[model samples]
Target: MPRKERERGAHQREPKGRKQRKAPSEGKERLPEDKPEANQLKTEQEKEVKLKSTVVDIDSVREKEESLALLEAAEQEDGLKNKNLGVFEWLLMVFALALVLLFFPFSIWFCVKVVREHERAVIFRLGHRLQGKPKGPGLLFYLPFLDVCHKVDIRLRMLKVPLHTVVTKDLARPELSVVCYYQIENVALCSAALSSLTSVLQSVVQAAVRDVLAQHSFSHILLHRRRIGEKIKAGVDSVACRWGIRMERADIDELFLPVELQQTLATEAEAKRQQQIRVSSCNGFQ
Candidate 1:
C-alpha cells in the first residue's frame, strides 16, 4: 500500500470514533436546554387557562348573587302588598257586620207606613186608641202585626136622601128627596162615632126633611123651600159637630105629588088663568 493512502485511512478511522462520543455529549447538552424552554411554555399556557377559569367563576357567582337579591326584593314587595290588601278586606267586613247589627232588628221587627196628603191614619194598639189623635200625612213606623191602622178620608162628600112619601100640615101627601153636602173635620172622632158616616148622614137628613115638611102647609113649603133647607142644614151641623163632620149645605132635589093631585092642580090653574083673561078683556073694552 502507498504511505499517503495509509495515513488517510487512519484519519478517517479516528474521526468515526471521536464523532460518536462528541455527538452524544452535544445532544445531551442541547436536550436539557430544550426541556427547560418547553416546560416554561407549558406552565405559561396553564396559568393563562387558570386565569380565564377564575374570571368565569367570578362572573357566575356575581350573577347568582344579583338574581337572589332581586328575587328577595320582589318577594318582600309582594308580602307587603298582601298585608295591605288583607287589612282593607278586614275593615270592609267589619263595617258590614256593624251595619247589619245596628239595623237588622229594626227591619225585621218594625213596619213602615205612608199616608197620602188627602188621608189620615188612626192607629190602634190591641183594639185601644193611641194617645195621639191621628198620624201625620207622611212616614210612620209601627210594630209589625201588633198595631192596626184605619185610614179616613178628609175630603167633602155628598149624601142623597131617597124619595119618600110624607104628609104635610094641609093633609097633602108629597114625595121628596134631599141632597146634603158635608166634609170631615176630625178623622179620629168621626171614625170612632160612626162606622159609615155617609149612611148616617142620609138617614138623618131624610128624617129632618120629613119633619120640616110635615110642620108646614104644602103651599107654604113649596114657596119656602130655601128656608126649609137652611133649617135642615143648621140642625144637621149642630149634631154632626160631635161626629167630626161639618155640614156644608142641604138642598131639596126632588118634590113629587100624586098623579091625581097633579092633574087636579093643573085643572085649577087653567081655570084661574081663564078667569084672569076674561077680566083683562072686560077692562080693555071699558
Candidate 2:
C-alpha cells in the first residue's frame, strides 16, 4: 500500500512538471506569431504615412491651381469690360452726331476745324487715340461732343534752359545758360508722347550741358565753346529722337564764373601781360 501511494504521487508530480515545460514551449511558438503581427502593423503604419504625405502635396497643388484659375477669370472679365461699349454711350454718341447734323452749315463753325499748314490735329474719340496718321492742313469735320481735337504745331521751336551750376574737371564751378532749337519730326508722337515739350526739352538740355561741361576744364570749355555745344546737341538729339523731336542746335548762351575765380584769372592775365612786355623790351634792346 505504501509503494502504490508513492507511485501515484510521483505520477501527479511528473504531469505537473511536464505541464510547466509545455507552457514555456507554447509561449515560444506564440512569439513568432506575435512578431509577424507587429511587422504587419509597422508596414501598415508606414503606408498610412506615405498616403498622408501624398494627400498633402495634392491638396497644395490643387489650391495653387484654383487661385490661378480665379485670377485668369478676373482678368478676362476686366478685358471684356474694357473692350465692350455700353448702350448709353452709343446713344449719346448717336445723339451728338444727329444734333450736329441738324444744325447743318451753321454747325460747321464747331464741327469743321481748319488745321494750318504747320499745325496737326490729333483726334481722340471716346478717350482713345484715333487710328491712322494725324489730321492736318485741311477741314476736319466731327461731332463736337463725341470727338476732341488737340492742335500740335509742327514748326520749329526754341527752349531756353534755366541757369545751371556745374563743377568742371578743373574743380571750377560755373553757372551756364543754354538755348536749344528743336523741330517736331512726328506731330502725332509729339502730341501723344510728351505733356510739356518745353519743360522736357529744358531739362534734357540742362542735363546734357552739365554732363558735357563736367568732363572738360573751365579753360577748355571757354576756348572750345563750339565743340562743346556740338557735343551737347548730339546728346540732346539722341534722346529727342525717341520723342519725335529733332534737335537743331544747342548753344551755350552765357557762362558766369565765381567772383573769386574771376579775380584770380584777372591777376594771372595781368602777370602774363607784364611778362610779355618785359620780354618785348629785352628783345628791342638786343
> Which model scores highest in lDDT?
2
Compared with the true structure, what per-residue lDDT tens digits does model 2 show for residues 1-286? Answer: 9999999999999999999999999999999999999999999999999998777575677567655644554453333232345788789888887887798778778888898999989887776566667897899876787788999888888888877788899989999889888898766666666898888888888888888988999999999999999999977876777666888988889899977798998999999999999999999999
TM per candidate: 0.56, 0.63
Among these predicted structures, which one has the highest TM-score?
2
Worst 10 residues of 1 by lDDT: 76-85
Which stretches in model 2 have alpha-carbon errors above 4 Å? 1-88, 269-286
lDDT of 2 at 147: 84
Model 2 TM-score is: 0.63
Q: State, as a TM-score between 0 and 1, how close model 1 is to the true structure.
A: 0.56
Error of 2 at 275 (Å): 7.5
**How much lDDT does candidate 1 score?**
0.76
